[model samples]
Target: MVDPAQILASIKTHPPSCLQATKCSSHYFSVLSGSAKHYMMFSEKICWIGFCLVGSLTHVFATRYESGVLELGIHSLVPGHSITVDDDFVICDVDIEVSFSHGYSSPGDLDVGITFDADSPVTTGLARNHSCGLFGPVHARFDDSSSNTLAVNSNTCVSDGSDVKPDGDLSLFNGHSSQGSWTLSFNPSRGYIQLQQWAVILTPCDDGAGTGDPHFKTWAGKWYDFHGACDLVFLSNPSFAHGTGLDIHIRTKARYQYSFIESAAVRIGEDILEVGEYGGYLVNGISNADLEKLDKYTVTHEKINSKQDVFTIELGAGKQIVVQSFKDLVSVKTVGASLEEYGGSMGLLGEFGSGKWLSRNGTVMSDAIAFGNEWQVLEVEPKLFQTNQFPQHPVQCTMPSTSNVGRRRLGESIAEASAEKVCGHWGDLKDQCVYDVMATGDLELAQAGAF
Candidate 1:
């Protein structure tokens, strides 16, 4: 009873979390057709490099598991100071550190051991056997991938290197479940060890979006198209990642019988960033230059060499909003954390994790037009625009009728086979690409659609 369209839409919208590793190399990697440089920032750790524009389109993607630090904040060495990592990442690597004040004895006297899932100590005698005979408060680190030379203090004892190995090498934990308790224990044989703090670094999670025309995809992987020419709330997540607030509003304009996103205004925390067609940008209704002085977010814009320009807004905690523009057409995308981690998010994007369309009143909508109209930005919401445009809040969404659809359709002149060939490998977006190409009579729209 499964629908093939829904299956393809899910796969096209939200590919499996790349942390699965196997699916990462075989699938989920996106290849953009251009020699021009393109960067796909998965997190601070992952990056994608674009290759040549001629012949074939190839992409070189390099990624590493993102790490998150959990503070232990213990003043003294306790038997079982631990933290739980509940994310679904594979436990590829682990590093434990302990900082202590200079007591009556040498820092080497403070012996430390760490265990995972109540198992044997991954490493022991971090400070006791290997402090490099250094004085002052010692910052000792025991890494799972260090040289396990415990007989005598090696030169590495002065650094992050470790003199002990886990019962099995750190690699043994690779592909193992990341959801477990990591316990840090110290020997009390040398009396109490005064410590400043202790902490562990573990891997984390990621998710986001990319949409254009009137075609939409929620952060939760739902896909649909709404040809509504009006301003609407694309996403409103007050609890977006680590308490960072985000509200994105998009304005769409009618083109023939179809519609395309014209502009987008994103409010992250106190600052507002607005991007529109033709590469113009505004921050809090001010000039784009003000984005450099943004307090909470890091903003960057690519050089505007072509018609379509890309801009990125970095919301702390590895979350970002990417805006792309191409002369009267614009698209918005999200990166880093998934919407599910935000507790709940609303607007035209629909429910956080449910693929069902949702109304602002919590009603499960049956169609895209109904769901999209419910999210129309109300006059009460903060107006991030410089000036009010026609058909503002209170006005119903201007739904475009498909009666004149044939006017934009591929006529008998351009065969369906020819249109498909010109659209290239757009995956599930090929149909939309073909339609946009015929509607505008511009082949470049196909590339812009990809952007």
Candidate 2:
């Protein structure tokens, strides 16, 4: 029963002293001044004890063995310097060794808890009130503890009971980078617990190069729909081992008729194969759920064998697009039947004919036929769209529109009532009304006061 708030409050009020003990012996003496004694104990059984006026009774334990007494030295704890882990490393497992003084009257008198990064607490044998009949060292291991064999010593007592078990698995840190500051906190609820040593093991994964060529390069950029009719875009990036993966992001425009990515494939060197398919439908008008499907697209083959060149994309049925990449100038073509119809050559050495089509900069001579009318490349910072960026249907106010003088309340102007009627039919152009009203300065403040 360890309360994190109470432990943190106690540590703030009574900070333990940092002291060095020069002698090692079977008997140790400590002089505590106040009711609450705060002691920082190190591995060598040495402790720097301090006192505070917290009015809470803390039990002190002293144990003596026939062979020898454990020696611990208390050192000043530094905030950031206490522990340092490599930035690129990934934690695989953790092993901690602790020793508790055997001066408790009963088994439940001692409780020891340890937490990493303020996560859930992992307890020792003392947490289950394991009888301290014979105790010198208790080893608690995370992940797998079957490999660790408890060492038995005549002078030192070891816990071999089944009351204590490992707390968490290494999967908690899987896929998470090991660069942040990891806080290892120790909290003892009932009795005094001494930490001997702890170790964290790391296993690194190959990020870019493993079996593939280290110098191999892949294309990574954003491709927008030629016209903004359909709120959909293609993002191509290099997966592990320099493989190409295409992610389709769709923003449905209408309700009931949801947009779905039935299948997706990339044409590489005249060969066409089904790359992957994300068979899920995204509901229109729900921006959050639809945006989440952007990253969930399936990439059948991560590594695509192709140079930095122009590639044709075959998206499901009746839809095709071309991506032209030269250095950093990434261009996309969408308003054509196929790569042959668009007159675009494939691979690194090929180029597309600049027919009666718009260029990458979105300068259009004629409107795109593949996408519906009213299509333009609204360029912003190249990033994912937010919830507010999605088109929202105009809300229709269902309040009664009454023009009678008796029904109209006091201070309600006729123009205000007219604007309300206009808003109900504004539909999708409701957002444009606000801008038009501001630009033209047509709606007088006195007349459009409610608007």
Best by lDDT: 1
lDDT of 1 by residue, 1-451 (tens): 3343454466567665544422211111122233111111111111122111110112222233336632212233344545555544433245455554333343334455556672333434344443333243455555555665443323223433223443334433332445566555655334333333455554322233435566787643456788888888888888765666778888888765778888888887787888987779888777666566444667888846567788887766666678888766788877754433343677776655443467877887787777777888888888877778778878877777777677656443455676688898788779877766665555666666455
In model 2, which regions exceed 4 Å deviation?
Answer: 1-42, 45-82, 92-105, 109-111, 118-134, 144-164, 168-170, 205-451
TM-scores, each model vs. reference: 0.53, 0.28
- Tens-digit per-residue lDDT, 330-407, candidate 2: 223342222222222211111122121233333433433232122211244122232323332232111122343343
Error of 1 at 310 (Å): 0.3
Best by TM-score: 1
State candidate 1's TM-score.
0.53
Q: Model 2, residue 308: what's the lDDT?
A: 23
RMSD of each: 20.9, 23.8
